[model samples]
Target chain A: MSVPNAQRQIDMLTKMLRIREFEERVKRTFTDHPGVIRGHTHLADGAEASIVGSLSHFKKGDAALATYRCHGYPIALGTDTKAMMAEILGRVDGLCKGLGGSMHLTDVKKGFLGTSGIVGAGIPHAAGAAWAAQIRKKREVVFCFFGDGASKQGAFAETLNIASLWKLPVIFVMENNGYNVVTTSAQEDANAAAGQPLSIKAKSFAMPGVTVDGTDPLAVAAAVGKAVRRARRGDGPTLVESKVYRLSAHGNIIAPPGVPLHYPEHEAITVFGKREEYEAALRGDPVPRFRGILVQNGTLTAAAADAITQKVVAEMEAAVKFAVASPYPKLESALDHVYA
Target chain B: MAQLPYIAAIDAGIHQEMRRDPSVLYFGQNLATTENHEFVAAYGHDRVRVTPISETAEIGMAIGAAMAGFRPVVELYMAEFMLVAMDQVLNEAPKFRYMSGGQVKVPLVLKAGFGFACGWAGQHTGSLTALFMGVPGLKVVVPSTAADAKGLMATSIRDDNPVVFMHHYLLTLEHGEVPDGEHLVPFGQAAIRRTGGDVTLVATGWMVNRALAAAEALAKEGIQAEVIDPRTVAPLDLDTILKSVAKTGRLVVVDQAPRHATVGGIIAADVVEHGFESLRAPIIQVNARDTTVPYSEPLEAYVIPDEARICAAVRKVCKTAR
Candidate 1:
């Protein structure tokens, strides 16, 4: 096991905690206010490490596109969380001036080209951005973050073909969260065992492919680091498959604790392993796991981790307050942006 | 004044725009095989990119490129292919500016060859101006003549919005005098093709040419039809059409699209609603038969609105059937 340095682990832990707390806070806000965050949200509860890990390798010129579960990405990309929270709340002071809502948080200056609600749509956007990078000689690389459901979209295949053909600097980060909405991959495909791993599908396009345990932030960062290096060196694109689980409903709209198994036991077991393993992966979430390792390695103590949590909590509290206080857009200004 | 074929004028116009601005580039399939070779020779391969035949991805790619500060003119080969990229067209590109709250401007022009008279059967023949008109942020332009084609090509490229530029297949074969250089036609302005007072003939795309011919035919019969060509739709020159309608007190709309929810239908509705007080007779709209265009030349001609159909609409609106 190649463990990253103590500092890297601490940083990942902090990011993971921020993501978890943000989603948790968003979930709580939505529950309490009901209509506070107007649009639907795809919370990033279990898939924190996959985004933060890969983005850790992202630089100033690098651009990233993610699916609708975008709150985590912009937050990790260093966007103004207050504005993002305001945007989700549909306040005029939001990042997108309250137009984007939860599904479309974007800050071009922050190198988050944006997020799309379309399942596999962001794939081509990344490929084109990478092409732009090459055309401008920007030496910029693009990272596309999508989910298991997106793999089924034709856009995923089309973008892969184009990216490899042009040798564009792009990384296809498949956050395999076990299920495509309610149907797990095993349920959707009768022979999940026989099928090649998702990353191996990159072989047809002659691009490098690798899989990592998404629960381990170190593993994701390492795999993505190599891909980013290869891309920066002009070695074309790579398909990096990070195995994770949603750990929540597709949108978490109506899901509650102790919800009945929507699918079969064999399906759930096949995806995350035995019940104990599946439960442990959720309970020993990467955020706490990394903190534990940091303590064991004498990097930091539990009190310090709690302190970090307190800081993040206070920050999110301020963001929500700012969003709640922000004004709604004027009704007459609705027709303003229809053109240029 | 330099006379050139409609295709050459548009090609030269694009080349001129590309030279004027380094940001303007082309993305389509087989630029080396088609009319885009001149583009490659002039601008090199980096700017004139011959993309693989993936309409959906290419549209998204073009939208992305536009979002990333490049003015890309993406060709859909035939307007029929716009169906494949409907998501990118109606949903993605059109909604980008509005949904982004004007933070992002999509200075992208999607060019496609549109018609039913080309003898290219059902799947290839499509007049989709109406389809685009339904979307709020999409601008649809169909320039009928070589001069207008060149001028409008430059204007659409320069515009900071998503404009659908359709080159009529038959119009491309027509020769006309094009302004030598830097000819620009602003959108939302209608060109008065012929002046008369008896009836107003409103047309678009190649139908403009047909309407002009119909107006000439009516002139010989003493009908005195005024012909107005709306160079662009969506910002449809409502003032020009309504002014002509008010002057003539009778309106006949000519369009190549089918009758159902087509551009002709929309124009007719607008005339009936806003130009109601200026009507001498019930407004007449001459559109193609609502059926899949057949491959045979005669059937193709039958499917598309032509001079005879336009003249007939004019006569009916004038109540002077002869």
Candidate 2:
């Protein structure tokens, strides 16, 4: 690749790598602290590039709505990593004030409407946001991200139809990660989950639908950029299916599942291997690669890269410490928050 | 002032509010310009939006607008339709303020009609005030008189939280004097429409009228029942209820919803919890029987709370106290 192109790839990868490393750390931090979060924690450790690429193009005021496993999107949207980590720890300073914990992270000020714990529930919310923006004559668009599992939900199709009908500026980004928790999308019982490609489903809405290589951060970024531009021009909603893999067990197993489990280790490893190879073939990391290219192109320098990373790390660390030092919420506070 | 039904008072309030604030908007099925109702003509198309058949999406749109700082009033047309938009009402709107760390305010008013009148059948006449009251963040209002209807509707529209304003289909034609001026009926305060000393008759929506009628009948029998109109179910006027229960030492709750999850149950539970020591008798609840509201007028009348049931419950509570 040319110096500029290689640099771009590197910058993207670094962000991806940061997400991957962050999730790994979260799992490790919580291993001994089993009481940190009750219920399930779906990590996005391996599916970093897809989120990094997709979020790269989101403007400051643009909205993002994602499914329950939504750590990566907020991280990409400039939320502090420590706060997210502390949220997993169920500390008061967490994004949702330790109330939502792992599966639901919401920061309205950051333009993240909050992640829905319900499958495909966020789809309608994103469409609603897009509709509001359109009615208010605001230029902002909303990006709704969900897994292939969510694509089969009734709300998903309903929202897609409405967005297209209203010509709302919304982008539906389906991350086809093959598995939804334990059951693979192919084995899901729903008729909609039956043999049709997702992009083809989007086409049924009479809207533009395309599939992209999710592992290729640049490809994902390019797809998002175009869709965003089309939406801003009032071309209506688009469904972009990013083909990716769940490199880890749906959550926290680290290795692939045992044979008795529906999602066998062989299939898991094979899918995981594809992501690993792509990640390895690229050199120096996406961030460094992009920074180096930027220096060569006279846009940024190696010193600036160090400065940006340092500032971001410090900011993230401060959020973590703040959450850790913050007092636990009062027991009575639960009553006040739920109803008001 | 002429007597107007509860539904007419609500319509009047909505029309008045829209005329007062251009930012205030209303949306629902058949509530727009196409209907050619005087309300739609006065509000105009810009403020009066006609929505498609997607109830969930419509409610979601209202919540989104409220989040974006637009004061939106959404009419569900029927309480049954609220099921489709339960996620938006219970999950999103209520959680917005706390979930966003008190950063966002959802100034959305969701209005619905409930209760059996004509043969609207099972789906059309469910009084969901009790179900909605169970939700922590929402304010549930059920008005009886036209004055309370207009005053409470104005208060709900101005309140920051998501308020569910339920009007009985029966009350649409029923009339009562409504003050033709600005008035705010604060929630959590009960109206002692008819005061007495023998027993406390707690009621909501149309049941308030039934309770009063029952009280009048009981008055002839020297029962002297006190009729309390809650008006708001969520910020329930528990203080007034407990005070009345303390004085009368007897309680009877009349609700239009089913027996299982009735507003009657909540009031009874509250009385038992707080007013148990002061009680001179076991609490009684007059609610819709444990069956769906039937389409046949006879079956419907037998199932829902009526003046007969209210009178019987008042007599029962009075007997228990004696």
Candidate 3:
């Protein structure tokens, strides 16, 4: 009942490529096109592997809850990219009818429970979703993705304890992008430097926890797949920490706090730098690395990968055009959702 | 129909609702110890859950469960603990429907015990009717009698919107008549506890009982005060309060929330704005002192607006009072 090796590999390549191309198109449309997007956007630049890798393991009807840097998951999960793009553009045709914007892209039908801008905020939500699934005796599991910055939060501590205690079908996926909005004290630098694996905390909660090389899509897939299977089997939750990088800024183009404006000027750098020092330490970009693995294993040809890339590029172009053509939400629609 | 204590009435409501709707979920810290134990025994542990002392997490999880098509009722031990889960209540639950373009319905009920009756001190006091009412999306309910508590609790569970159901800590032990089986007291409906002609007293939660006592005291002095209990705040029953004010020609608002942006002041403003010609005197607001609830019994007693204060306010507003 396993996915055939070549098919699985191809699926990974296609999802990762789709995310990279979609993000690139979004970045250009957001930064270059004037007045397209308003407010903050945290792109999952280098964490595409973790997002797609972790999500691929989840079966249909399973839920995904994540933090703000979540554009990649929905795109890779095959949510209507045009609706998401329109949402980012604040159009009525968008997924959330322009109210949720990029940070809140959701298609619950696809089991994307939605995203929250608050750090560690979505963790408990996943616990709740998993609890509902358990109560209904549904074989659905919830994958909760959080950041290292959020790991130290009280929500993290509390959610882990409750999730483990109730044995909810939840897998905690930590996308450690290594910066907590440029605040040294809040970031996980000290914990990571403590010479201990960050995922080890799951042991304290009496659940399995493992750290995987996040850039290696296969590694993330293996770790998350194991966790997912454990959850579906009613073995309680597992913490799978994928040590990835946020190749984009905390926001799409805006720098994290304390860094000078236009400091890295990533419009052409292709790599988002948190700080010059951290930039050098950043994990390798996952898209190209994943492509090389596929090609080397003879699972995919260079020509095949390029074709997928071209297809995604064309789709993104049309999506951008659709978003631009969509109409702005009516003013009265703002008050529509305040009550039932 | 049968007479039941506030706690038992709430227990009966939850028991019946969970039995009626399979999607209803109940969770909180130490729920196994509360009135929820009966439901757990009947429905099993999955639907009726006991969580760790994770206020913020429980609130977040409740919102999540509600989002995924479950009616989740989260019980915090006390109302003040709601501060820990403010973001989930104020930001997420309310905004979900609007953000999803009216596609999502957060049938979430947040239940908490309020008031200084149990002497649980500062962290356990304050019926925060005004705070939740101030938010646009939330429906705030405060029930006094055991009958009203059971009915309101049932209605809150069935509501397709987020509701903050705050029970007065003092009223939990008091016994009153509650209908057996299914009963729902609709929100935004005011209950007239006592009728009078000289002055109108608008009260909420346990304050309704206090206002009734105050009305009795005023009747002896021939003041004749009307007591109107606004069971819910957000979708407030302003029509009844205004009609009472017009009929009485004098208004005195009473509640446990602080003075600033309090429900008392909100009612006074609405009465003054719409029923200006009907008023014979300036409106009087009897509310708790604008300070954090202190731990001492006497200080706590002084912080809450008592029956004497309501009577005194009624006397001050009525010119023909003997």
Candidate 4:
């Protein structure tokens, strides 16, 4: 839409790249040195722009419930990158005090209710947060993100149905990475007799449902912006499905190679002119694209942009060092946070 | 002082607590307005609420509201219905305090009526009090009489921890005199119904009455049976049972729950573990059969623990006492 405000677009793209870069480092660290930290790790590899764009629409105090693949949302929502890195390292300095580890990172101060590992478990919690806002007569919207598999959960439909009926201010952002774990929608359908598009399921609850290109941050931002406005106006919940691709394995640690193209990873391959042509496109990273836009708009300079990127990189590198140096949580602290 | 019936005391406790505290509000499936609306008539519609039969969401909403600093008394029509909101109650409520690193105190009271009553069949009647007792950080109370219900429930409502109070629907019709004015009975304390020199009869829930009745019958035959009522099962009044067993030299525990690992199992295990030295004879446990509470009147009678079973256990324990 009108290419967005040049400054806003820059901010959105910067945040998206920050997520991509942060996750790329996590992948490298996990692969290079195994057993430093271990568990079911789900990183947002291909779905970067979708999270950054949508989350940028809401301010501090508006809440969000993210799924297992939640590293990006908390970072974008202003949780300390150091604390987040510490969490992945299972250090006591981590967010959730290292109690939640990776999948359950939460910064209540930032209004990020903890991400849940159980598929669709956090949907009702998001609805409850939105319901709380309505009861308090506060103009706050809650953004709930989950994967395609989670959308199939009963809690998803039940929560959406109730939220629509109650007119609660909640936005359900379904990040359809074209697969649920190793199984695609096509395989899921062939496995099960009932073959139906999941977006239609969202519409069945009387909420407006639409799909958008998740790779395109601007499109996702526009769609989420509309939903946020609608919710702020008390028009009720909206379901927006973002179609994207996962560049890495479903989890942070990839299975041994020769796993056969799980789902349709190679199906929608964007072909270039030649190997040299592809290398040329790879040089045009989103960081430069964003920096060039900000400079042209006069909101920033090329030199100032370089300084910001360097600062972020330094901060992130320091965070990585902090995590590597930090010790894991004591064994006794394991049962410490079971209640609160 | 004459003891009160557990059901009537529960109703009175809820009524008095609501009147005393303005912040306390109540809601459930048929709480405010049933066809007769007995629960609301005693409390009031503002304080009492009726919901649209959403067991899970209703409990979840109440918990969320509690997290937002509202004291809510949620009524789960039956203890069996608690299964619907088990995740919210077990996962969210208990886990919140620890998850928040002791920042949250779910001062939420959940009222659940358990135990087999009438002929409501398998689903309607099931005593899951012992089931909740297994969960750490949750306080469970099985009040057997009106007085115990009033006092224990009052303490439960004011306690910082989340409490699941179990009352039996059959005892709702059983009335007894309750002391007026504020009287809070401490939890983890047992009520000694009868003092005897022979054997100790440990009981909880409706089984307390049966134990007392059996003790009365045993008294005529010179089989002195000391009947002990464990008002709250979770923070069990173990000292009382141990003391009674120490004196009487024998023990028999009667619980309405199934015969598997239950309150009876807990008492028997704890007594043998802690009070075995003073015991004159091996402990005996009388409980419901190892199955669901059947619907048929005769079959239900056959499954649930009764006075005959309690008396038989007492007689056998006393006869075996060295």
Tell me the deviation in Å of residue A46 in model 2: 3.8
Candidate 3: tens digits of C-alpha lDDT, residues A65-114: 88877788887678998998899899989999898888888788788887
* Order of models, best DockQ first: 3, 1, 2, 4
TM-score of each: 0.94, 0.87, 0.93, 0.83
Residue A19, candidate 3: Cα error in Å is 1.6
**Cα distance off (Å), candidate 2, residue A29:** 1.4
Error of 3 at B271 (Å): 2.6
Per-residue lDDT of candidate 2, residues A1-340 (tens digit): 1122555555665576557656655555544333444456676754576788888778877888888888888887867777777777677666776777777787777888867777777787787678667766667888889998888776777778778877888999998876777566768834335766667777778898888877767778888778888898888999998877655556543433331212223234455455444345334233444456556866656677667666555664565456556777777666555544
**Which wins on lDDT, candidate 1 or candidate 2?**
1
Clashing pairs in 1: none
User: What tens digits encode model 4's per-residue C-alpha lDDT throughout A1-340?
Assistant: 4457767766776677677767766766665545556666777866777888789787766888787788999778877888888888788787766666677777777877656677776677777667667655678888989987877666676678777877888899988876676566666543222654456665678888878887777788889888888899999999998876666557643445433212122222332124443344335443455456568878677787777677777777777888888887788987774433
Say which candidate scores most in TM-score. Answer: 1
lDDT preference between candidates 1 and 4, better one? 1
Instruction: Report the lDDT tens digits of candidate 4 across residue range B162-203.
Output: 788888787776777677877578988888988998998888
Ranking by lDDT: 3, 1, 2, 4
- Model 3 alpha-carbon drift over 4 Å, by segment: A1-4, A184-190, A252-283, B33-37, B320-322
lDDT of 2 at B114: 84
| Whole-model lDDT, model 1 | 0.82
* Separate DockQ for every predicted complex: 0.65, 0.36, 0.68, 0.28
Runs of candidate 1 with Cα error greater than 4 angstroms are: A1-5, A189-193, A254-278, B33-36, B320-322
Give native contacts recovered, as a fraction, per prediction: 0.51, 0.30, 0.63, 0.19
Q: How far out, in Å, is residue B138 in model 3?
A: 1.7
Show where candidate 4 strays beyond 4 Å: A1-8, A187-197, A252-307, A328-340, B1-25, B31-53, B103-107, B150-161, B178-197
lDDT of 3 by residue, B90-117 (tens): 8877776776666667898899888855
